[model samples]
Target: MKKENSMKRALVSVSDKTNLVPFVKGLEEHGYEIVSTGGTKKALDEAGIKTISIEDVTHFPEILDGRVKTLNPYVHGGLLARRDLPEHMKTLEDLSITPIDLVCVNLYPFKETILKSGVELADAIENIDIGGPSMVRSAAKNYQSVTIVTDINDYDQVLTEIEENGDTTAETKAKLGAKAFRTTAAYDALISQYLTAQVGLEDPEKLTLTYDLKETMRYGENSHQRAWLYEDALPKSFSILEAEQLHGKKLSYNNIKDADEALRCVREFDEPTVVAMKHMNPCGIGRGDSLEVAWDRAYEADSVSIFGGVIALNRKVDLATAEKMRKIFLEIIVAPGFDDDAFAVLAKKKNIRLLQVDFDQKDEPTKDEVVSVMGGLLMQDQDTLKEDCHDWEVVTDVKPTEDQLKAMMFAWKAVKHAKSNAIVVANNERTLGVGEGQPNRIDSLKIAVKHAGDLVEGSVLASDAFFPFDDCVKYAGEHGVKAIVQPGGSVRDQDSIDMANKLGIAMVTTGVRHFRH
Candidate 1:
């Protein structure tokens, strides 16, 4: 075995030869022997740097399409043998093998190949590195003595430490070892994920998901719970998670959850829209020609419920809208962008969190919604269904007018965003009142009607689900609700139809229920 005091040997093999030429030169300056594979040795020689090939170290030529080079026992023994243990040192000493102090390597371009369009299976298979990961793992396992460097970004740090202090620190070795293991794990995960996608596995019995930690929170919903924010390994599109905080305190767990709901609701409208949320339920929603008008009407929809709520807008926030939003003590405000003056004004308040997300980067609505349970996860298709007036059947003898149908359609969009057992009273493309998360449909109706006050006379009512009995229709009639829209699949549908006709109310069945729970 080679003496540690005199000189050390380093094995350098990398598919990503980012800084290898200069790095290998540095090793030679410090009296270290560099051993590398075919291309690395050739490149080092071409660069006027001395490097011994693996064939010279193992006394065997690289064969079997170059797969048989570093898998030999001479290389493995040099890497795996412990210098501190007498038996391990004797094994290497008897075999005339030297101990490897450093292993600098990165995996094959498997990830790059998979990213290319129309890449062949044989190409992907050939790019999978066998000896590289094996050597990296071997060196990382002996981190007490062997330093494993996987990333090119770490090259300068390693070189600086070696130039200053003859050897790399044990702490750096441990950190680099951890990064090596993680890199291999991520590599295998990508391969598995890509193959699983190709085979069209809708729902595999075993599900594996990868996420990278983005932030560590002080606490969760309650201070007793610890929390962290992890982004998806491969994000599908823009989301609140990627939002840039322009001003105010960092978002809390509850704040992010409610903000997500608000943003998703506002994305449903193509016009200038505003949605205010509390506890993940939208309290106020409005659409108008301008964002200022939308913000005004949405806040007025339920002024009491919007306090300390999260706000989301689909359009750029102008100065007029920003000033109006600052009137209330809000937890968050999210939009695509803000006017310079508006942003300056909003920045005055330090506690309210402000975020900007791009409107063009919105995701497709039909993706899966995943819910985590005690021991597993549940996934289902997202509710992207839209109600068409042409598909609706007007059950009452008095049919809804064109304007009334338009109002009902607007109300349907809002009702879909509300929780189950919802009732929304909207007119002129704005919600006047909303009742959601109630135990019974009657209570929801009463709450919605009561909130509307006298405005319920000409407003159209929308229910997320069908009316089980005629009582809701009777109450809507008594309250002077002119039009009612609901999904008509109940066994007693005729009862509500009869009540609607008798009360001279126009009722329509959309055939599509918007139950959001």
Candidate 2:
């Protein structure tokens, strides 16, 4: 009489059995029948909980090496039937199928299987769940009549509701359905991406990316904006989004963006290099025999602006380098590593963020960069192509000296990270001045010259793009800049070249233009 009048049925099948015994026990206390298959049923029985086998529910034995158990209509018919519809009940009555009110299912471990060392293709393929996704979708589609649970984290809430109210509220059911759909979608996307790559396609025909929430930030770019950080389900090795934070408070949204920008720029060099950044532009960059010297050069490049900037180093931060760093008020400092003595010294500044990057692990940088607009996204290649002065042509009669050539290359690297209409002045290995985000090329050049002043002498100037007029070259010569490097593609390029020749300044054309907006 209790089974006929008050009992409810729950279908539970899961690969991850975390908290299964207690959750099932909670359901049983409220007169709910649990029907399970395979290892889940065995675990439930071992925990001294009652469970009806899939064979009893389907009236058929599991066949095809345990693959065909839940694929039967008996399971789906009960899970999907509309309780309010007479026709559905009539069909179920004719088939003697019990309608399922609650469904608990989680997908197979395809992602973990593929990540294991030496995992065979057959093993990965076998782990793909055909029945689990189908059951999840059916339960989600019937959320008006059924409750779905995909995550073990939701078990406590679900159990509490069923214990107190005897059923989940409509709002809870909708939310669970939404999560269930996302779970299956992510599972399918991983399988699709993995198989496409294994079949020799460099990229899949349809790119599918899935991410799990890592944290909810206080806010986005502004306090009014909402934001959350999500890491890839299968992360790449070199992504800063997945980097471990070694010290200091939790990273804010702005800190993550600026730190990532700083690190990416520093990776453009192989020598001992330091990059100081503000508002996503490189305020200073230095290369030296030691990181300590590099930090000083970079800081001296813009002592005032580097006060609250982020710093990135390509080599280890030693105690000497940390000494130079401890003087400045930096938002973040990241390096491949820090000497224990250096970390000990810097750790005293409790507020400054410190991060140790892993350079030994490797992954390809993203092929595409995406920008968000009002209604859509703008996407482009990540501009990862490297340029070399060795590939450049000497456009002026006066050849650049060996030292000047080296300085030009260094300035060229810095110019690429500056905003459009950019100009960077550098000596042999460190930046002297940077003029960025100007409306006109001449204005940017003037700003750099003013910043450099006497330092402009003997320093090479690097432009992000070709000069539309000869005035930039004239201005450079007046400031005592001895060499110039720019992409030579403008219609009046020869005019600039003529001015360089006339001013007795050496110039080289890199042929490649780097435009950062």
Candidate 3:
């Protein structure tokens, strides 16, 4: 049986009313009646676009500050009624309820509320919409008989389709329904994460995460594997996933991952710092009074690894810095900001990925951190970057010199990029050597010393984790390591301390641990 195609009804409710007036008016022009609740209805009425109040449709007043407005069976039945089902039509007729043809809804600003300072639990709970999710889910589940619109961006398209064809296409309805479900899922995941964070259950087993795919990449690590970028919530900071490509090919999966890591590492410093990442691991890192010097020093740190790597800087990219960066072939170059001349210079490299990230918006929690085990999924908190170093305790015989102290702090920041069982040696704001992803602590120390070579003399070493034995300290001394920083929590802590005193190397315990694995 063919259903009647007379004036379709759309229920509109949105926290962000951007472009709502034109959209609602367009719907009205197409012989679609708008049913809206609370602020949305008020706004439409103020604009002289008549709307049926939700209370009129549901035959119930909005009590409890509008919380109980759309939760009734009338609302769900209108959205869920099967157009072709005889039983569904009979039920709707018996209740004297009109079937809802379309639902336009967006949840309250839970993500925004959590980001604001001093947001109380009551405030956060109040923002969680009960009726909104139910309506969205009902519309989505009955996509065959209903159309759902959750994003304002879809308003124009939906209006055009209805105007041209007298109804939305099945394909369009299916797509919108998919988007509606995704919206509700992401919203619920955010609420779950907030409650979990408040309770301090950060363990991987206890963590639950949900993210929507932002984009599918051209390829993964290689062209053979598939990859896509996802975001938990839209991050305000300079994020590769959020960046707009002015020109050049779409970023590969590896390019985005490496670019993100490099940007995060570089953004840690207020001063001009440059970080080059390859395959999601930092290959070169340096800081200087000027960005040009920093870029040059970082390139020199590991010129071989910097080839086709992602480079990130804390400060704005100037012409000189851009010129230096152009000398090498790179996959991407990201900075907090960029000057006109600098962007022009980089724009010439047609293939290089250029991104200007908002350093101010960079530190939100990632959507998910995944690790594949033997036929299982292992998830946990993202290896978030640390900003506090004041808690470090000096735990050595000789104290570090003022200059060495500054260099140690720099090395400590760099070491966070190294893989687990990592060792990093640096001096004068430059990474002298880095040993990462080794099986044992001593092997990582050996690699660091080997890479530093003669430069290891008078340099500071930073370990991502505590030393299990005194041999690591003795090895550092043999290579002329004069200062060390590690999270001192080994069973043989005294042995390592004694070894440091014998070698005359200043060591400090960071009380806090940074085990990447």
Number of the top candidate by TM-score? 2
Question: Lowest summed lDDT over 10 consecutive residues: which window, candidate 2?
Answer: 359-368
lDDT of 3 by residue, 291-340 (tens): 99998888878888889898988888999999888888998888767788
Give candidates' CA RMSD values in order.
4.1, 2.9, 4.1
Ordered from best to worst lDDT, the candidate numbers read 2, 1, 3
Residues 433-460, model 2: lDDT tens digits: 8999999989988888887878898889
TM-score to native of every candidate shown: 0.83, 0.91, 0.82
Candidate 3 whole-model C-alpha lDDT, 0 to 1: 0.84
In model 3, state the lDDT of residue 467.
88
- Looking at model 3, which ten-residue stretch has the lowest summed lDDT? 382-391
Candidate 3 ranges with C-alpha deviation above 4 Å: 1-39, 42-53, 83-85, 108-126, 156-166, 169-174, 195-208, 234-238, 242-248, 360-399, 469-471, 492-513
Give the clashing pairs for model 1.
none
Task: Tell me the deviation in Å of residue 247 in model 3.
Answer: 5.8
Candidate 1's displacement at residue 214, Å, is 0.6
The per-model lDDT (C-alpha) reads 0.87, 0.88, 0.84
Per-residue C-alpha lDDT of model 1 across residues 1-517, encoded as one tens digit per residue:
2223358899999988888888889877776799999787888889998788898889999888987789988888998898789999999989999899989999999878976768998898889889999999999899888989999989888877787777788899899999999888877787777778779998877666667788899899999999998876655455888898999988888888898888888877888989989898778888889999999889888899999999999988899999999888999999999999999889899899989987787754334677889997788877776557767998889989999998898888888888989999989657888999999999999989888888899889999999999999999999889999999999999999999999999999988898888
